[model samples]
Target: MSRLRPEAGILPPVSSPIAQQASFGERLRALRQARKMTLQQASKETGVAQSTLSKMENNQLSPTFNLMQKLALGLGIDMPQLFAPVHEARISGRRSVTKKQQGREHLTATYEHELLATELDSKRMVPFKSRVRARHLDEFGGWVRHEGEELLLVLEGDVLVYTEEYEPLPLSEGDSTYFDSTMGHAVVSVSKDDALVLWVCVAQ
Candidate 1:
């Protein structure tokens, strides 16, 4: 699987459930075509090089966190829409059920993420399960920062959370931490095995 940029690594491999619905390149192409946008127009709107956008649309390039944010903002859609297909319209009383190990998987060097409830569109909260794979800070190029607040609950083993503005905090199974997602943060497993956590990010 091709990995995303080091700062916010995540890529849906061919075997991942999310890839079954649509590849990132296919989704990008669809969105651009739906908007009647040419590659030049998309590049201008996204502040990305035209060649880069072309490569992305052709599945020859994986986006970084910064690129994803720019694409979302430029395309007038939320970040999750980059990975999951969106419903045609929003409606009331909507719900989606995900069976065990059935959530859309996005793998990264530092974390293996399973995005939950991806069938719904325009969600206020994005929930996912992550397996902490990094054991050291150097594994990440920089902190992963984004809009909104985040809640992380340790599911198994132990983790050490690092934030740009605070000392490292250790968390055990059943423990959790909530913080501003904009502060820049990363988590590493400190246990014998990789740790698991339920992470919920409140979108703005």
Candidate 2:
């Protein structure tokens, strides 16, 4: 990871107050409305059931990380955009700074994610810090697959990376790997303590 100098005026602090205040249901509805998409349409696009989408939009249901990923991909938006407001204008020299442990959090059964640079829309890459909480492959509902490429760097403890096409690989702190995002994959902590990792995914 490259360190940015705080004194550099080129980097601006990014905050998502709207995301922090609104429920996922509200945000989802807003996005759908903005795009003039119906729940049935969203269901078809996301591969999620219409009843599930309706329940989610009504705050009667909460989506898992995998489901959220599907939603983001179907909506043609980044995962962070599902939580924050979208800015459509294109700008040059854009940069954001997220202080330690200050990124927007998105929790799941197997991983706790701190989504970084979330205030910026139309990002080419999505960066986050995550804690591996699952201890076994069975903890995940299924393998996670999505568009683009991914890079994972272990920050603390140990983890086992499992992919559809390869044997599980163990990684320790400071170890990193890059792989195609389209391949189904999941990660679990192998250490007593949950492992932490920096994950960056290229937007496809």
Tens-digit lDDT string for candidate 1 (1-204):
122233644455657665665688888889888899999999999887898888777765666545766788788887678778877887888888989888877666688878898877667887889999999988986778766798999999999999878889999999999999878788999998999999988856
Candidate number of the best lDDT = 1
How well is each residue in 1-204 modelled by candidate 2, as lDDT tens digits? Answer: 122211100111123442345577788988888889889898898998898888777765656555777898889887889877887877899989999988877666678778899899878888999989999987776677767899999999999998877889999999999999877788999999999999998856
Error (Å) of candidate 1 at residue 94 is 0.9
What is the Å distance of residue 156 in model 2 from its true position?
Answer: 0.7
What Cα-based lDDT does every candidate model obtain? Answer: 0.80, 0.79
Which portions of model 1 miss their true places by more than 4 Å? 1-22, 47-52, 64-69
Model 2 root mean square deviation, Cα atoms: 9.9
Model 1 earns a TM-score of 0.83
Error of 1 at 9 (Å): 4.9
